[model samples]
Target: MQHFSLHTHTIGFDGQNTVEEMVKQAKKLRWSRIGIANHFIVHPDIKKATFYAYACKGNYQNIYSENFEEALFKFFPLFQEIKRIEQITQFPIYKGMEVDFFDTTQWKGDFYRIINLLKPDYLIGSVHFVDYKGHLLNTHDMKKASFMEQKEILKIYWKNVRSAIKFKAFDFMAHLDLPAKVGLGYGKEWEKEEEETIALLAACGGKAEVNTSALRQKDEAYPSNRILKLLAKYEIPVVLSDDAHSVSQMGQYFEKGTELMKNAGIKRSIYPIMIADHIRQRIYMDWHFMRVR
Candidate 1:
């Protein structure tokens, strides 16, 4: 049995614990591997987006900078600290970033440039906001309004998700049915959209995270049982993520999470290990391989 957590957060973003605290806690909990995947967003338009502003702190402009350079400038110190902690702890802490996917018209060029420059151990593609006309609307806010009225917005959300998959810039997809955060289902009419998204993910050599964080909100782990069944049908790979924001949350409820994966009919998980020359090759290995590293 392998013990590792691939998705986590620290004080650099919205998390409660610092990098050092997270690593030490994981060690105490006897975790073999962990990844610090803080938010690495550079959406300049968040300042005007009501939902985003409120969610990210309305008055704080420094959090989401206008360009990648400025955002990296503020983020570099935390990145360096994570590397330092990895050396000190000698833990298998991989560098990761939970990146937001935006449409090409919005900031495609910047997105490509940032990924090329940062080159994290892995990139977790997530869609929290959907492009409405020219404005970026938070998907979670859609629940605040009637589903009938937000039908078009929801459609566009899935559409953009397909586009994100086509971009093929990420290694894994996070919270596949994220719009469901609002408790709205895709219905039979949108089943095609769901299937297409899952197929694209499989075709792109992408994996989905069985995120347990949703349980904290009293919701099922993302991708729902229906979506997970589809993933299983398509033979798509899956991984476990705590999506932890604090020390106490690391691997929280993972026992139940593994049960969810088993019920979904998923068997193996992929772990990316870097070889000489720093190239990340997705190698399916057991716990002993990870421990000896």
Candidate 2:
């Protein structure tokens, strides 16, 4: 099985490992490439960071101001360090961010500004929260919610996901069926909407990710077999990710992910480095200029 992983996290955000440690683990695992994707600016409407903090029993409200610049500045160095590490190791290390795309209407302006500035090697758009009448219902916090509430959350979550793709801020949609992974909802009743969502994602340049993290939860990998088949049928590209939070999880379960893809009859999958091809082009342009000089 091919070995690589793009959806990983480190200490710059909530991840358990540091960049150096994660890289070391990747090398130990004999991975050809590993992309470090840290959490970027969360949407104000979703308030993900704050919610996560509260859920974890920590104080996150004061970590930054209303503007979010302070939190961003704090995290910027991690990206710089990732670039430096790539230079030294000569191994493929991509700079990426996992942005919460909960409500495009509310966060489109912030999302565009941050994405333009970062110019990340890639972006993983994920919907972590759903808006219900102005209140945000976090998927991770569903243990406290009612069954009806969870169903409504999934409905709005998919709607926001569609909006996120339309915004075109990410290279791939992270965990397309994330709501279903938690067993919050999504069955036959949602099949039509799922088809529509996949169609919309394909219409845009965005693709879906086959996230393996769901397996740890005893759930089928994100974008289950049925969804993967739909994506393949529509000719939508799919990327595989471990969504690893620690070094040990780097490239975790990729063999299974690839097997799932094969069973879906998907002959090809996108490697994360494909997103950095543009940078390679620019480097070539610079070299040509030097030769002319």
Q: Highest TM-score: which candidate?
A: 1
**Which TM-score value belongs to model 2?**
0.85
Give residue 55's error in model 1 in angstroms. Answer: 3.5
Best prediction by lDDT? 1
How accurate locally is residue 245 in candidate 2, as Cα lDDT from 0 to 100? 84
Q: What's the C-alpha lDDT at position 62 in model 1?
A: 45
RMSD to true structure for each model, in Å: 3.9, 6.2
Cα TM-score per model: 0.88, 0.85
Whole-model lDDT, model 2: 0.71
Q: Write the per-residue lDDT of candidate 2 for residues 1-293, one digit (tens) a residue.
A: 55777788887466777888888888888888777877654545434443655745653343222344654675578778988888888777777777776454545666567656666676778876676776666667653667787667777878988988898867788988877656755568888878899999888966778898887876478987888888878878777889998877777777788788778877667654342246555311000001100
Clash counts per candidate, in order, are 0, 0
What value does the lDDT take at residue 277 in candidate 1?
A: 44
